[model samples]
Target: MKNLYDLVVIGSGPGGYVSAIRASQLGLRTAIIEKYQELGGTCLNVGCIPSKSLLDSSKYFSLAKNNYSSHGIFFEKLFFDFKKMMDRKNEVVKNINNGVKYLMKKNKIDVYQGIGSFKTKNILFLKDIKSLKEKKEIQFQYCIISTGSKPSCFPHLNFHLENRILSSTEALHLKEIPKKLIIIGGGIIGLELGSIFNRLGSKIIILEPMEKIISNMDDSLSHEMQKILEKSSIQIETSLSVSNIFKENHEQISVFAKYHNGKEVKFIGDYCLLSIGRIPYTKNLELENIKIQKNKKGFIHVNDDLQTSVKNIYAIGDVIGGKMLAHKAEEEGLYVVEHIVGKKPNKLNYDLIPSIIYTYPEVASVGRSENEIKKDKIEYNIGIFPMKILARARTSGCTDGFLKMISHKKTDEILGVHIIGDHASDMIMEASIAMEFRSSSEDIYRICHPHPTLSESFKEAALLNFENRSIHM
Candidate 1:
């Protein structure tokens, strides 16, 4: 009875820990389990936080090396300390990890460091991660499974960290900058890491199996991003299916691929990074003991209320498989907690969840894409405004990318907003909020935005969508 809880959350990732905090806030006796020595999971430990830290450091170095001269600022013998950059990133992650620990203590949520496996519908056995020996048993009235995901590797290739074949995790902690890095996937992870090394003076070659990089985004975004990256001297090879990856020697690696017509090619590099995607991590949860259901892809099955097949057990985040973004998982975690408390919270609006890629120019989008709108056979009006034409872009000298807005043809209601430019990550909320309130193009256009700002592009695009004309252009 001392080990009993109203809710037990497995995994201390964004979803798991956040849910536990929320449950505690709502007066539910809660406990959270994490296998790792640290809290915050992948996003904090090796994913978003560290990647962004490196990105900012690399970007600053790049600006001094490339752009500063144009602004009449010059530095003699410019150099960057790669080790210091990595140290800062590690420190940032450590601070956040401690912050999460503090939150758990402040909320009075019991934090168990071990693997939690379901012993029965109402109980779990916590086992030592290394020895796999049972440490303790936990009883709960309800459980939330927030175990996140891991990076996926090629099915045919046997990958090892020592072989120079790396996932995002290994890529983030390299001892030295690679002279040549070959990336196997051109999604967010690949492009972001590639951008970092390319800025730091590594030759980057991105091989994407799809027709375009970031193929899941809007077509305009994919095309424009590819062009921008190419201009930065990052080589992109699309429509090439990789057949084999092997270590050529202690100092080199090779990746083999073929064209659609079967022309074979070999790419050699010091390091080969696989950034294809991620798969649900449901390992060691012992779901079978409780007979909870999962989909073919190993994602836990959740109904409309995010309840698993076993009603008392619920799952959220990457384990349930939707966007897999940290914020998405956090929202799901909050929703699940609120639902458990008998609060009639609104169902999550998946469409309004914005997607962002933190490349040099950045990319963000909300609501339906142009292709999705077309596929749905919705009559729509589109407006595009180039960044180069803006005074703010000229001032900042980052004149690459554009803002595109789509609206219903008859009603003039905004359908989607997509942007690729500086500060686009933060700028996307305007569109998301607009779409959340079902605002029309006219509404955005009428809202006064400050002069000479990146966000003005949004207003201009809205005006163009509403009346097929923009004042700036």
Candidate 2:
């Protein structure tokens, strides 16, 4: 007997699993397939979840080692066990993985664990990861590719060297912190992993090809974050392209690079982390057989409806590219499922989606940046609030960032909101809500905010757009 499904999702990541559940909810018989034993994909396994777990644990340790002394809390001996921390992180990953499995069962979505490939228009070939020769076939009306992405490595530093060369995935599972760590990219992953071990006593040196870190974000946020990381003893060398990586000894590796100015530089470290970014992962999907149209970069081409060139087959998440965010993929999954079920759901507001960096004094932003508005020649008014004056920040001693609001100069409608301070990730959601309603700076300013809180800074910043006055400063 041949098994059939209304929708068959390939790659049980955020996009795949969510789409499968939604499809089943919409009265479609759905099935999801994963190559790995776990369903949460890279984000739950080695990317966002595990990295954030370690980062959060290290942040508290750092506070105990540095800030707690000022808060009148003294420790006789402050020490942390890397093994315990890693174990806790692994435990967290397992819990989330199990939760995902529960969701699939509750939704009655059939899950097949194996490598899936397209053999024809409506047929899929499946094989066990261990026993590739053992094959199974399934039929589906529609398919979604959401394999997610893998950590990109420098061309010069291959995984063949093993321990000396690390990707963000390997870095998260390290048994011991390196005395000196050299990161090759100054993007979100590098900055985050660097912050983790730096707090745990590793000397971090970031080598960025760009002139500024987080170059895609608001210039102010990047500049401020760079300064903060520098003060935390995280060295950053920008505008350099790596020329070669040489193994110095069993204990150290030498990195050679050149500045844009043609000056050669050398860096030696116990370990090197390559966090340049990620590429679309469509591994073993047999994309060539179907001839699904792909870009030069291997990203599957999808239209507004998330449908690829093959009408019934769709692609989302990192495989199709955008922000390479898990939430973005989740939204795309829901969107595709709804569209397939004949529901008229409004298109997602990509501009309003928030991007967050989980470093200490977390960074978050939504909508167009001031520079983006400037490039478009949009006359915009700006409201700025320094976090140093916030009572909550003063009490917490984490007053190192600010909140900025940009709005249409004449109408006062908010165009963007950028934050870099404690609870910035949580606080940005409020801004996202306000912007979703097309709220003006005046609108947000008039809303009541609790006193002695980090969020109050946004209200004050919004007030700046109207009266150029903030009550505190």
Best by lDDT: 1
Off by over 4 Å in 2: none
User: Alpha-carbon error at 152 in model 1, in Å?
Assistant: 0.5
Q: Write the per-residue lDDT of candidate 2 for residues 36-107, one digit (tens) a residue.
A: 989999988989899999999999999999999898999998999999999999999999999999999999
Question: Alpha carbon lDDT of residue 94, candidate 1?
Answer: 97
Q: What's each prediction's TM-score? A: 0.98, 0.98
lDDT of 1: 0.93
Candidate 1 runs further than 4 Å off: 156-159
| Candidate 2 accuracy as TM-score | 0.98
Prediction-by-prediction clash tally: 0, 0
